[model samples]
Target: MKIFKKSDIILIFAVLFVAGIIFAISSLEKGPPVAHIIVGGEEYKAVNLVDIPEKQVFILETHPETIIVCEKGCAYFSSAGCPDKICVKTGRLTKKGDTAVCLPAGVVLTIEGGEYDAVTY
Candidate 1:
């Protein structure tokens, strides 16, 4: 028995072609890297990662206390007040669309504006 029939192969190729086109368009629209800090569901600050002159740390207004650090072209949660500390474990947010969230503190740090190649399972 044939593994992939003629129609099946054609459909697979067509899907890949459309995916490539969408990826290309999305890549072309990317901008410079930026990090946005949100507190209590509101945007607290937006930092241009590419324009950072030096490493910086910020303490947000949250219970338990949360800290974020940014340098060069990346940002990350250095510390979090939540017991889980999952946000701190998230490491660096170097790529666009990367996010670190501390649920208890109501804080989120996300990277915005940059090219993302692909996400693999």
Candidate 2:
């Protein structure tokens, strides 16, 4: 058997490293492309969240005291008479399974879909 040179070993490792990174990036790009926004038990279907326009806002009126505005995958309690602004502090939600809840206002924001056919839990 022939002896392996140091340069050959280094070259092999570099190629393996680049291959791993390419695999990871491709896998990340192949997942589902839907975001589910739920407010007061109602679900809104949004596709390709990154493509949402900056100024396009959605208003959700769950109750007289609860009003939410969602624009570009970010949601906040624009107007709420609730005692706590917990929902507002929850910040923007973009990933699947993320949620924001306002107990007093009875509103819930959630993201769904990940190797599952339907949204549950």
Candidate 3:
């Protein structure tokens, strides 16, 4: 008896073809890179990271204050009043889809646009 069947091979090829199409469309939709800040599950602010004349810092006065710093083509959580400070440890976010979150303060910073890339845990 054969372990592989013709129908199974055709199904796999069809699935791969659809996945490739979806990936191509998604990649073509990206635009200039920008950083969006969300606080308390709401959009708080957005910063264009494509062109920065100088380093800029933003302070969010939440339950526990948080700080964001942006330089040319990169942004990061520089400080957080949270006890763990995990957000600050996330380091600079220079590529599309990068993110940093401070759970205690309900603050999230994410980079969007430029180009599409594979996601990682």
Each prediction's TM-score against the native? 0.72, 0.50, 0.70
lDDT of each: 0.87, 0.59, 0.85
Candidate 3, residues 1-121, lDDT tens digits: the string is 7877999899999999999997666546577678889999999888887667898899999879999998878899999899999999999997676889999999999987865343345
Candidate whose lDDT is highest:
1
- Order by TM-score, highest first: 1, 3, 2
Full-model lDDT, candidate 3:
0.85
Question: Compared with the true structure, what per-residue lDDT tens digits does model 2 show for residues 1-121?
Answer: 5589888899999999999997565444433334554655676545444445664444655554655555654445566666777877777665555667877756776554332323345
lDDT accuracy of residue 113 in candidate 3: 82
Task: State which candidate, 2 or 3, has the greater lDDT.
Answer: 3
Per-residue lDDT for 25-58 in model 1, tens only? 6546577788999999889999988768999899
Q: Which candidate ranks first by TM-score, i.e. highest?
A: 1
| lDDT, model 1, position 108 | 89
Q: Which parts of model 1 have CA positions greater than 4 angstroms off?
A: 1-28, 116-121
